[model samples]
Target: MASLQGKVISITGAASGIGLATARLAGERGARLALGDIQAEPLQKVVGELKAQGIDVIGTVLNITSNEDVDNWIAATIKHFGRLDGAANIAGVTTKEAKYPHLAEVSNEEWEFVMSINTTGMFYLLRAQLRLMLPGASIVNASSGTGLFGRPGMAPYSASKHAVIGLTKTAAKEYGPKGIRVNAIAPGPIKTPMLARVYGETKEESKPNEESKPKEDLKPMSTIPLARFGESPEVATLVAFLLSDDSSYITGTTRATVTGLLGPPRFWQPASSRKSTYGYLPAGQELEGEAGSPRLGLTPAQKLAAAEARRLSQAQKRAQGQLHRAGIEAQKQERLRKKRVA
Candidate 1:
């Protein structure tokens, strides 16, 4: 692991989710932080928490969409910390409306809003940070799984994320000679407030009765091979790795933090439920003496082993699903308690 002691780092969207997770871990690693977010109260709270722990931190209220705000935040960082070693631009937004309409129905306002924050705002942020960063600095930007592959009903968001990757690559090349590194992270369906909003669920209605609800109803989560959503700390670790000297040779690439979810949600059936063998000749049937023959049988032992493997895999998957539901319940209770306090 790269040593973060005494290093000064800047982070946007530091009030919550992956950004907040990164800030917390970075602080624990001994880095001084310059945190910025539009949510002033939450940002200040985080700053106070870190300061109470003896971590050096400064917080600012910033709207990434404004060039001036971007510049000011960077200036504030340098003014407070005296230098910048790394930065994570983890702030971005999606549409408020769920079930995004077709491309033809996407409004001009929606397209511009997403582009302004996700792309143009990133440009501003990167430029400002790079202007003050010394050689050997690193920066990580937020991208999405949608950036790598297209999905229906999310043309604007997808396009904006694709543009983010482009910016990351171009910046890496432009600054490589200066010893600065740039990279992007593409995460799929993280369990964040943003995701809850995307699913049209508030804290009160977020957790469902797993026993009563069919597993298929989980939609995207069911499609992931892990059968669970990723936690914020998972992405935080990736961002920290990219920002640290541990990843000195890495740059100009988009790293995915999804839980083995390659693309769109597709209907998945377990091995026993699937009708086709998918060309897996059952474990150990001997081929006929004929040169070009196919045998469709399995030895008793082979069948037993195969069945054992499938059973173990299914059992592991079920355990993971149960653990994920438990986590969701914990998150729900915390949210509700916070609401009550407010």
Candidate 2:
């Protein structure tokens, strides 16, 4: 919680929810804030609230799903604040893939639209911000428990979230050696406008608010050990840590349990360590868990709860496989410590 005084930070999807909470937290920490979103009125309201409280803030009503808008927001941030220190790549979208989609009936337009905003949009903003980021720069991408887990109605959302993990990992590896830390947050359900839009209408008109909402909340929480949805501010707290020096030693990590959404994806432990749990071993060797966990014909819980860890492990294996087959020699570059230890 070091003072963020004079630190310049940018956030997308800042009009509401996680982005707005983050802006508030960042401002309270003395960080200068540059915020972007497609909703002009709410975006301005947030900026107005911050400015009234005497926090230095600039709001740009820009769609993160647009490359031009991404570039413009970056330019606006530097123009208004004079420098960039960190960013929260939080803007996102969902498609029918995550809600009411038929695998064989998915329209091309719907598929492309979701991928563009949720995946490409994040990459666009990060790239734009990186161009002007100062040393020790950090970036946090907003991911979801859904990305790590598969929901019956949310494939696009899950896929997009999965892609975010991939992007953050690659960026962390590429940038950490240059003193930039990149990470992601895979949040569980939060009762944002987005969630209200989905669940609010599902309840019967006669259902009492207290009883219904609690039941609705518990639906997802049943999967979570904590048994609750996280508040937007909760995720904001961790994003702040990743941006600050407090997390200097960490990178390429996607912290997903902030909302107690689900545990890391289930993995296939080495046979030598198997103790006969659904997927556990005798416990002597390090669990090379999701590194090779396959999704083919998985059980229902396995598909949703441990999917992200499975994807991550698959990606890592692919990388290692390429490195071995190519036979290309490469050296690990140092980022923080200058001297290579013997």
Candidate 3:
């Protein structure tokens, strides 16, 4: 475990889910916490519990969608802690618009609602943290697996998450020189209240008597090799690692907790049948050559074609490298000629 001893870390959405798990873990690891959440009661309850456990902690109720609220929370954190060491931007939302509706059918209201909190609000919080943080400070933003790949009916959420990655990478490059690290995590199907609501699994629906009854199909689990949902603490561990000095060299990257589901299920193949050279074939397509096979399922001729394609790609890269070297030589010669004339 990475030591966060004496580090002052601020966490958004700390009232529940991964943020709550991270706060508990970070506190146990000796970090002083400034937790922010939209839920005032839950946030205070968590803070009081942590305080009882002898964890130095404070809670702020603020709306992430408001720049003023975000700024005030950061200000409060700095005032209490004296200096900010790290921050976790864990606040985000998803709507029923992500239930696989056609892109054209998605309501403008839903789109704006998701973007306001996930993207614009992230911009506000990240901007505030960047302004306050000094060298060696770290920031982790929450993204989702949907961010990396386009999912049906998830236009707004996907677009926002992709933007998060773009922001993380851009900030990493800009702030790397100053020794501030920025990164994002793309999680898949974590068992949080948000996900429970998405699956229509409310507390009433989760009673012991209802446990014997069949529930709605969990489509996301079909794609995951792990065959189960991830726990909040599992993600919290990664967040803690990123915030600590343990991941000092890691920045400008999005670590995925997707349980091996890289993309859509259609793009995946079983591990046993997977071939390095063959690459990914569509689901339900066998690799063996056969008549009337799926388009993605390669035959001998297609395999040969793929090999030829690789050969051509390698040749093109080599030619591009040679041209690049020649261009550098030309620039050097031009500089030498200019020096001689001078």
Q: What is the TM-score (0 to 1) of candidate 3?
A: 0.75
Top TM-score prediction, candidate number = 3
lDDT of each: 0.78, 0.71, 0.80
* Model 2: per-residue Cα lDDT at residue 156: 62
| TM-score (C-alpha) between model 2 and the true structure | 0.71
Clashing pairs in 1: none
Q: Which stretches of candidate 1 lie over 4 Å from their true place?
A: 203-218, 259-342
Return the TM-score for each candidate structure.
0.73, 0.71, 0.75
Give candidate 1's whole-model lDDT: 0.78
| Candidate 1 C-alpha lDDT tens digits along 1-342 | 656778899999899888999999899988999999999999999999999999999999999999999998899889888999999999888653443555787889889888898899899999998899999999999998878875555678889999999999999999999999999999977888877655556554543233222122234543344556889988998998898999999999999975334331111223342221111122233222122225333444445656989999999999999999999999999999999999
Per-residue error (Å), model 2, residue 115: 1.1
Give the TM-score ranking, best first: 3, 1, 2
